[model samples]
Target: MDTQTQIIEQIAPYQPWLTLCGVLVLFLLLRATRRALRRRVDEIGYWLLGERGRLIWFWINAPGVMLHELSHAAVVLLFTPFGFRITSITLFRVQSTTARDRYGRVVRSGGRQSLQLGEVQYVRPQGKLISYVGDGLSGIAPLFGGTAMFAFLYWIATGYNLWDIPLDAHQNWQLLRPDWPWWTLIFAPYLILTVTSELWPSRQDWTGARWFMVGLCTCLLLALGLLWYTNHLARVLSLSTFMASRIDFALVVLVVLDLLFLIIAELTARGVRH
Candidate 1:
């Protein structure tokens, strides 16, 4: 076995009990929190069910949409003296203004070019060939920004560690890793999806792309849960050999599924020409 597999195998024996305890603690905590927030949660749920309330929620969160654009603007400033100006900044709206710099260049290619919040726009340069760099950087701002954020958060929580071992290591019914922090487990799936979404191609024509991404993320989460369950079952049954083999296989399958969905999404996005 490879080094990683060997290490995991060495650690596997301690996982079952630890995972179970972690689950029990997480469940109790969540139950307590739910009880505390029951009324407010119910009220918000009722509000979200109303069409007008849903629309208002979207509007209120609209400024988050500008984060990708702001990342691009920051990148632009690194390469050019001409700075970007945010014309407006509110929870519902963002407007930006930028001028060409002497250091930037223009491209004459006929790719889709427009000034959307998270899109790459090609502008004509006054005389230089370096202008397209800023646009290219802006176009990919979301991927870089989200990746940086994810990495930073992960580092802060885990201190460059690959895994965390739980305080309790005697229970064997839980599917999540015991080593990870409870907060990390809760938010990891969302982080994964957001990073994946940023890296994937943006489809302007097919509004279904966002939903498709959500579905893909859901599938990945389910796959991960299944894999964890299988491992847990193997441990509980003392089927170490089978567990060792199948866990790796299941991980490979999940990776393949993620890649396939990403490829299909990118192709679908590129097919939209307008």
Candidate 2:
């Protein structure tokens, strides 16, 4: 085999294991952080309007809402600030005075009991081409931010290299070891949580984008499942190994903690929105 081909073969077996370990670690860190911030999670829901607020605060601090508005403002500032007048940028909504002719609305539900909705009405400017940019940017800000954060952390931890293998032209077997940084092992769980939450499915009117994201999530879940299966299989194949014995115990603890934070965030967001 050529040098490149030989290198690829050497690295392939360990890739699956590395990816799975990273995911498991990331999930744990995120769950732990969520639990630590239980009170803050309540505040985030209030900020998102997931729960009802008395008066002004309801409009001001709604969870995940402000990011949406700032996204709009940012797009306008970058692309078309000339005609776009940002009237109000709040947590849940963004208003622009310039584009009065165009109309768009998005409604989101938090279970059957509560709903959160937003409408964007804009008049097309003299140049109609730039009108949609602001809307699109605002819609996907959370996903973008979350993914970027995770990637940044991963790069820092891994030195952006998955593995290292040096070889001479003779095609002889060279050093074989994963070159992951130590910090990656420490913060793997946080990275997984951030990426997963950012990539979670949400209601979007655009079917193409929605389905694309759904597919991505399915692939990720499958990868995680395969990792778990491999670990179990390894244990079963061994006569007296305890490698997979703790898998169930670890999973149950993680799932319970994950579900608790999810419920709290949903409830808080609902209360502020109402």
Candidate 3:
């Protein structure tokens, strides 16, 4: 083989793994962007409504918060036969508590300064082996649930199915050109905004499932290692690449939504102050 062909042959086998890693990195970055946009929106709300701003923010994202907590509850209930029990489901509560860092240092210590949007309290069976995986699934339920919600709302508002869109970036842009309905223009933004804002799991959500995550990661690594040993890794990785391509459009939509809200907040802040 020529030098160029030799290089291609050497690097081709790992291409799927590279693509999957790239998609995961992009997913993490977009999630951070979503969180920052949420904080910016809250800041604008405070500037516009003062002490009542927190309440306004809560109500604005109420639908999403409900869904987030409900997703957790649903997963917990799904494991009910496995000895999981729901203690309580709080859809909305404004609780003023001292905010602490990961190390337990107090960050905020006085007044009504925190909002507890929603929570699902559940008890896991003490001796059940399956509870480990169940806990992790319950913790991560909001993400899967939120993605479904986002796709559905997008379809309703745009009359276009996000999953049905071609994976080609250029083709996707071309497909987005059609004018949306008048009613969509009025209500769709609010609906999309509410859902995306609360799509991620909170720190507390992850904390309770650390063991489950560690165990799950260990199992995945072993499986991947076995596949690599048998020389079947490339085929499996190809599937990863395909799945990554499917989410590319969804990530792009999220970035666009984040930018849109950030722009609106900045403009409103400027307009209000002047």
lDDT per model, in order? 0.44, 0.46, 0.78
Per-residue C-alpha lDDT of model 3 across residues 1-274, encoded as one tens digit per residue: 7999999898888766666776777788788877777676677777888857747667878888988999999999999988999999998666655667768787764554665777788898776779887898999888888889988888877667876663355544433326656576467767877887788888877876778889889999999999999999979877878878668767777777778877887787778767
* The 10-residue segment with the lowest total lDDT in model 3: 168-177
lDDT of 1 by residue, 36-85 (tens): 33333333434545523323322332333444445555665566564333
Measured against the true structure, the TM-scores of the candidates, in listed sequence, are 0.34, 0.34, 0.80
Q: Name the best candidate (by lDDT).
A: 3
Give the worst 10-residue stretch by lDDT in candidate 1.
159-168
User: Which candidate number maximizes TM-score?
Assistant: 3
Candidate 2 Cα outliers beyond 4 Å, as residue runs = 1-73, 91-111, 115-127, 141-143, 161-188, 199-274
Position 238, candidate 3: lDDT: 75
For 1-274, candidate 2 gives per-residue lDDT tens digits of 7999999899877654644565567567755665554445546644754554222222332333433334435555555464555554443542322211124543333333323323323333554434454444544555665444444554555444222223337766432224644655465544444343333223442331444345557997786688677776554334212223233233343454456556766676667657
